[model samples]
Target: MALRRLSTLLALTFALGAVAGAVGARTAPRMWADQLVNVTTDDLRWAKTRVRVNVDHWDPGAQTGLHRHPGPTVIYVLDGEVEEVFPDGKTVRLRAGQGVWNPARTSHNVRNVTSEPARVLAVHLDPG
Candidate 1:
């Protein structure tokens, strides 16, 4: 009986630990990108253009530090909300289903100011 009780107690403890770890991971401030498509083509006038599509995940209060792309890019919010901050001090808030276009070499940063996590689909037309 004592051995059985110990085994049960160990299982409960492990279950609780797993739940806690999951919650912690969900709330951690972080960002990740999942690339969906990447294609390079020479058919366009510019020639050798790379088209890339990615799904980006942002945790609550997560931010992408100032950055720039080599070519034009578009970001569409898929869930939650995000704010885009430009180098010239301009800021734009985008919600689910909304999107923005950034010209080549435009420097900016993105942040999730809300309490909930956010996700966005990013499409890029980069010069190859």
Candidate 2:
């Protein structure tokens, strides 16, 4: 009976450790991204383009460093609010139901200015 109790205690300890690890991983800072749509335009012979759509979730105060896309991108705010900074030092705030367009190869940075979580959907029209 004593040996059986020891075995049970060991199993419980292992299980608790696994659960704690999982919880910690979930709480870690990370960006959650989901690709919602992908399509390639075949009708245009000289200007064929690939379109990709994504939904991105940002943690509070998270920011995407300055980056540029291969093509124009349209971003719509889905929840909370975010600020977009252009290379010219201009900034704009977009909240839910509002969107903005960025020209191809436009350098910009997106940052979540809210104290709560935020989400946005982006549509990319890529030529390549």
Q: Which candidate has the top score in TM-score?
A: 1
Q: How many residue pairs clash in model 1? A: 0
Instruction: Name the TM-score of candidate 1.
Output: 0.67
- lDDT score at residue 14, model 1, on the 0-100 scale: 38
lDDT (Cα, tens digit) per residue for candidate 2, span 13-110 = 33443343334332314553331222222222344655555555677778878999998887877677889998889999999767888989999999
Per-residue C-alpha lDDT of model 1 across residues 31-122, encoded as one tens digit per residue: 33331222222223334556555556687777878999998887877678999999889999999868888999999998889988876667
Clash tally, candidates in order: 0, 0
- RMSD of model 1, in Å? 17.9
The list of candidate 1 runs beyond 4 A from truth reads: 1-46
**CA-lDDT, candidates in order:** 0.67, 0.65
